[model samples]
Target: MKNDPNFIAAYGNIPTFESLEEREKWLDTLDKIYTEVNDNFEKEMSKYFYPNGPVIAYGYTIDGVLKVAIEKGQKIDAAKENELYDLFSNYGQNIAVKDVPLIIVYEDLPTPTSRTSSWRPIIGGIKICTEKPDGIKQSTLGFSAQTSSGTKGYVVAGHTAPSIGDQIWQPTAGPSANKVGTVSKVGGHYADASWVPYSNVAAKIYDTDTDVLKDVKSHENAAIGDTVYKSGITTGRSYGSVTEIRTSYDNPLGTLYRQYVAGYNCDGGDSGAPVYVYVSGGVKIVGIHWGGVGTYNSGYSTSIFSPVSGVQSDLGVTPLTA
Candidate 1:
């Protein structure tokens, strides 16, 4: 085609390149144009992003395709796809949600806030609340862990207003009789995590479906294409795939960064639940579920998590894998 004068006339002049370096150099101008347009698109496309109206949206790579990912929902504006198509005409394109390989499917299965009286040995996935609990204040326990000094404890959502010495309880509606532990340490910045020190524990998670205890033998970070699962008292155990990494969301807690978003369903009171994948012998925890797409804080109703790495670094506690 480079030597065909007829083809050149039909299209346009093709850049000539004899080396790989030359090819990249020839494409630099195109790259610059795409960069500038996409940058501006981000600023202008905010109107159609998640939390626009009960939607989940973010940018990430899936199956090697980088996209301005957004959940297709009934509440979203009908013209959103059209607007996006027009805006990205030159720089990019939009794919239908059906065609997209990964998406957060909402189950919205609401479980009662109140749980049983108590369990002799506490575990993750069960509800835990503050002194008030108040249903809203209560959230799922992230997992069991131990401080560097061997102090046994548990982890939960930091956005639940963690503070040292703060009394905690298992089950959302605690009546003091259900007292479990107290906040010993807290995580901040990119990880929405906190630790509650307690003496009694199973060092595992309460599996709702199997109605058995599942061991967490290790911890790992979430990758873009990995399949992840969340175990919460409210939603039970649900599976989804990791679609976003280093994703950021702004809320009352803070603008969390490097967060992971798994294409799974979750609801209120699910926060602080453990996110993980099944390993050879047991489970390797990946993250701690926080809030996602909802009516609050431009929410995406997506399942957002603070990876185990950041959680460990922030709280100075190692997840009890044994």
Candidate 2:
């Protein structure tokens, strides 16, 4: 439509928001378009974009414009672009193509087994698992919930859990001693967080600095420029800001979407660490730390996170509070 703000924004022009409510109103429209486009991509669009195809991958709205990252040597066909444009309408026209194929997804190389001597308190970022010899550790103990069995369970990264019924323990326990919990459910592949059927873990997160104890209460989504914090087994507690969201990339199993990116230092053992935003007196769960790319201060490093809401929906649990 003529004079549409989305249209204006499409041509590299800034769309003005008269008030906070107006900005949110525009964001609602943009988010809806994003959701509809992504839902269609997962359901019907992915098949059309295969290896070396026109539409290699889709991305969420960045600066109110939807984007599609194309293969190195090709561009999206006009017809397909138009179809998206028609769907997104004003903002959809902003859907543009880039040389790179969205975000690149990579798996972390397994680290060599190294043992820590003493048993540490069970908290976010501490290693805990059922695997023998060397047990896997908890991500950020993302949240806790009262299960249908009336007992409480905590959250961790799914890929870290070796099996559904595996008994969880601290790494120092070496398969026997410090039993902490068990993996009640595992959601692998695109869904990364798993559920552990135990309440022994505390809601507080451990920081490498040993100063701040991140207490997570509610869950929220990351926005551009929002300062975020994460506690991981490898990197300990790190601070960064959200740079991108509504992002996606191709993984081994399939295409993954609705992921966020931050400028933080993260490593292999850090997977499943709780990523949250600090609020008054506590923090709000935002995303679960996963594998990231590049190096810190190198101008290319970025920490990737799976939205906490997605994990909650998949695992049917919430972050533990007080």
Candidate 3:
């Protein structure tokens, strides 16, 4: 049976059977047992006599028992099922079913979100100012900065509120301009704000060719249940579902202001990270990492971030040129 080309074509090549007589004897025994079964008698007899009747031999083994499923929709009777089970239980223990093959119907299943890899940026970093006079301390998680004209900025969370002309670092790699800039504006909660490049730093620091900030005049926005992603120098990257949106409140430090975007866990160094929307082509920066209420494992609680629209409306800054 293993040497047959038709069988080999369907189930791939296998070693030839040791004895044709032994193989024939085993198949004959299965046929006889199936023919005697009352429920499957007619079907079995027809197959036994017909040129193209369904064959009833061992198909394959899953754990220990020989698997007896239909090659096609060819139905089996209760009696045949019982007889086959009995035969397998009584004398099929030592039989090798590994070389046996069976044809099965295929079905499709849903793809899980956990296995999905899709996200992109919508907004880019800009500078802003704080309305209050008191400075906010830098945080381990970081804050989002916004300009009065609505331009966006990446504020170092928990860090002291930076003043005008203060040199700021653009963690992104590039030329000297891409590496650093000076504080320009300030406002809002936590005194989180934006800074402008004192030199051609914006062009030098950001990858004008790929950085979304180089093109998008306004930051991206997101709604509840929207998909989002974030990336930073600290935390590599991550994706999650947005559980909430625009929310306001206060914290022990001071009055907190931000839009809540829920998702998976992020860490302290991830502060000031850029949040993006996942698209087919690339990532679109939508917001900046401000702070969140929950721990990483418990899942994202209310993650606070600055909106791109607010950044644009507050700051007249446009996306950098290529």
Model 2 TM-score relative to the real fold: 0.70
Report the lDDT tens digits of candidate 1 across residue range 1-322: 2363211111113345687666444344333333443356447654554445332333433332223343333343436544544443434333222222122222221121213335667877886767544543667888888888998878888867467777777664447777887787777765888788887876688756656668998898877668998888777787788765533443435434457767777777788888988887778888888865433322234577889988888888878876
lDDT for residue 177 in candidate 2, whole number 0-100: 58
Better of 1 and 3 by TM-score: 1
What C-alpha lDDT do the candidate models reach, one value each?
0.62, 0.56, 0.37
Please give the lDDT score for candidate 3: 0.37
lDDT computed for candidate 1: 0.62
**Per-residue lDDT of candidate 3, residues 1-322 (tens digit):** 3363223112212234477665445444433332233234344423421123333222222111123323233544556545545543333233443333222211111010100111111123222222224442112212233334555444333222335665443322234543344556543442233434333222111111233332323246765456766654333456676643322332222322334445645544444555666443344556556554432443343355555554444433333322
TM-score of 3: 0.41
Residues 1-322, candidate 2: write the lDDT tens digits: 3353212112233357787776555555556656667667645456445542444444443344444544444444557555544544533445442211112222222121111223344455555543544544443344445454556667776656646777656653355557667787765434466777765556665544544566656677777667888777666777777755543443322345677767877766676777877777677778777666433332224677778667766666666665
Winner on lDDT (2 vs 3): 2
What is the Å distance of residue 131 in model 3 from its true position? Answer: 21
RMSD of each: 11.1, 7.2, 24.5
lDDT ranking, best first:
1, 2, 3
Model 2, CA-based lDDT: 0.56
Cα-based RMSD of candidate 3: 24.5
